[model samples]
Target chain A: MTQITSAHRKLRIILWSGAITAAVLTLGLAAFRMGDDPSHKVTYTGEADIRSQFSLTNHEGQSVTEGDYAGRWQLVFFGFTHCPDICPTTLAYMGTVLDELGPKAENVAPLFVTVDPTRDTVEILKEYVAAFHPRLIGLTGSEAQVAEAAEAFKVYYERFEEESAPAGYLMAHAGHIYLMRPDGRFEAVFLEGNQPADALAEEITIRIAKEMRS
Target chain B: MIRTVLIAATLFATPAFADVTVTAPWARASILASRPGAVYLAINADPADTLLAVSTPIAKAAMIHSVETGEDGIARMSALATLPLAAGAVVTMAPGDMHIMLTDLTEKLLEGETFPLDLTFETGGEVTIDVPILGIASKGPVEATQ
Candidate 1:
């Protein structure tokens, strides 16, 4: 009876060890697969798994989505009006880029999405965007809606307290301009300070011409 | 003779003490009166100095700030207590880089207008400059039309 009991105990230990190893291997493989997922990658160029979707309110206070601007290339940028330097510089250059595009600018929709919805109301956004360019449209929404839109584009933003700043706070955000294709796909990204207005315009013009041919 | 000699000394002493030169000092027109504005300029210090403080009459407070872009593509702006200037090195403050942040403006910075900015240095004393208010889309002081 003692011998039989010891054998059963040894068999139980072996089975438990085997189960643990299999579980660990399965989890490791799953983690590796997740790391390899395209959607998790953040890249500068090429086909990134970024979805073009946002439910936001335009500067005109109209509720719009990605579907509203279908069949046109979308040049989306995220920033706030209160931003004193970077945002204004980017918007200013974006205006120049659109102007350089000439009539081809009609095929592109430039959007300025606000990361600070608490301070950027519709009226404020209207005036701010007007100061930049006529073709530029400003978008703002509730915090949740804005978060959803930012996540869809893989844009990161965070608010921190600043004693000397206006309204006692400031926001740090990504300054990349995402170019989305007409079919709701990411075509490319433009980083501020990397290229001048003419270079950006030329790149966009080339992509637009390619789209026309295809 | 004494009065003429004192006048001559004052004139020569002023230039000798003023070694820091500022050029292309300009500010962007604000979209709203409630929003803050930024001023950019190039500083050339002949003897190397430290920027102690900045003040403007148009705003309640002016502070020196630096903007740095992180590897994650996020731009972060932080206030600097003092900015050191190397001798003969042109420290240029431009948009998306180092700038003077003007907060609590008394009025909107209208395009085609100008304001005064006073910068104090540890060794160079004070230099007051008239900062022009360019259009919001102006890339540089010369490119205001563009």
Candidate 2:
């Protein structure tokens, strides 16, 4: 083989270096743009597209829709005042989380929607929610309204009869606390016994930080 | 009521075996006019047994119930006629799971009060437990010494 000339070797090296620089610059710019995109900032694990729309009555006897809670992060739970165990436990946990959040709690709203609206009237909800976190809003409406709300949130609830239960009826419902973004999109869910208040506070704090950054 | 109390006391005095014991029986405080509340406890039985029924004078009726989460993730409670306890098994009736439901309360259960409960077993016979009243937000039974 003939020996290569110095000029020919320099040309080959410059072309290869230029190609490498272009690729690196393109990838860097794309990653920077992705960081600026709000949708790509931080998505919660197990995010789903659950519709958030409903017309219900708040504990204050005021008619409310999802729009009433616009522009704020929301923590929503479905339960009834008549529920003895898990409902109260979750509400207390929410109270503790809010208390731990301190002033940052102002950026979030907690809602308790009654699965059994037949017995949970506005007055009853007002009393029930006040016992928990002062900022918690209790929502209840007619049976049809409550059903529609539960449906929109993908919440499962059914009232069944048990011979030994009061009036032979009790409501069986999912015990999940749903987190929604300020735009009312489903973000994540916390199972009843899985996450404690301190961990919940950390999650909320992280999400709020990501949102603020975005 | 007097006779029921006496029977409960006698039954509690003689446990069928040292291993068969009820621990940390507790109930949630029921609000005004609310007809039903739930009791949670832990039961440890050796040589196996079945929980046939539960009774309490403070309520019109009491029964065992278990909350099941469907594949769709909805939770619902169903009456349990008998709960089989495996040999050397420990069963916990806690929030969001199996529990003893008390209906038609004679009086509202107040926090800091202890009430009597009678549990009938298929093999271990019957035993009485003093269920303490816990706060509505309590997740588990408070220890007796605590």
Candidate 3:
């Protein structure tokens, strides 16, 4: 090979450095796009499995089941009636997000399932839910039935006695939104309080639209 | 009723309303003529003071409460004798959170209607405000974020 000049050597080094950097960056981007390699798949607890069923009562006191919302995409949130803070806030957010979806939102039902059936009776749920969105369906059942449904959806709830409390007892439960397929199959989960990279309505609309097309 | 007590107390009035001053109130208002609930209110203050107690004419007892959560995820709300409003601090009485508990309400709080509430402070003095009810009129002992 011809003898390389000092300037040529410097140029070669710079070129090689840039090429290597681009290659490494490309690899990193590809890895990130893979969304957690198989070896590192994230394990989420309390996820509702596919084909599970629960018997409950809707806010209108109508007997219902998981299959009641089969033909359309459904977003389900498990919360309690006594939850004055998080539950209503979540429902409000969910309502707002769904409302943002507009016409496409019609195919996606946002469900508010009560974990505290002891207090959130059919009538209570109707009044509570009516205050929010007209479409929002609040479902509740007996304690045992609610617990079974909660387990299937992977929710955690417990009531602590506050002997000194003058503001009635309080209940604490999980904050998670379950996105179910049109056929009532477990699809994916959107964790609460996550500021998603994309708008929730857009993301869910895309998923629902794609599922509808299929 | 708190109003009755206040009126009765004022009937024995001695002029010293200068020691306490409660102000800067924000909350929901009753916009309707008839409602089945109560309104919420919040306040802010500077210089340490104690919200000794609250009185309201709308209910038999209006207690100052703060939200609390237990280790097992149970949320509870209890009355507070004094909520310290430090210098440049803010106190809120919102839905599903810390609020002025109006028990055994006497009047029907509808949208557009304003009910009176009296809050007595140890240092900042006393303030009477109208808390409008605008939240869901449903039972909520389960969804606690204390």
TM-score of each: 0.82, 0.77, 0.64
Error of 3 at A45 (Å): 10
Task: Please give, for residues A1-214, the per-residue lDDT of candidate 3 as tens digits.
Answer: 2211122111010001121112221110000010112332222434446433678889888888878887888888888655535565567667777777888777887788887687778878887777667888998999998888877766677776543222445456656677777877777765433432125677787777687688
Q: What lDDT score goes with residue B12 in model 2?
A: 44
Identify the candidate with maximal DockQ: 1
Using TM-score as the measure, what is the rank order of every candidate, best first? 1, 2, 3
Query: Considering lDDT, where higher is better, how would the candidates rank from best to worst?
Result: 1, 2, 3
- In terms of lDDT, which candidate is stronger, 2 or 3? 2
lDDT of each: 0.79, 0.72, 0.56
Query: How far does residue A182 in candidate 1 sit from its true spot (Å)?
Result: 0.4
DockQ of each: 0.14, 0.10, 0.04
Which lDDT tens digits does candidate 2 get at residues A144-191? Answer: 998898888888888887676666677888878888889888888776
- What TM-score does model 1 achieve against the real structure? 0.82
Model 3, docking class: incorrect
Q: State which candidate, 1 or 3, has the greater TM-score.
A: 1
Q: Put down candidate 2 lDDT per residue, B1-146, tens digits, no spaces.
A: 99999967865454443234565567877665464788987675655778788898998888787878776557787888888888656677877777787877889888999898888777667677778887766655332223
Candidate 1: lDDT of A54? 95
Q: List the residue pairs that clash in candidate 2.
A: none
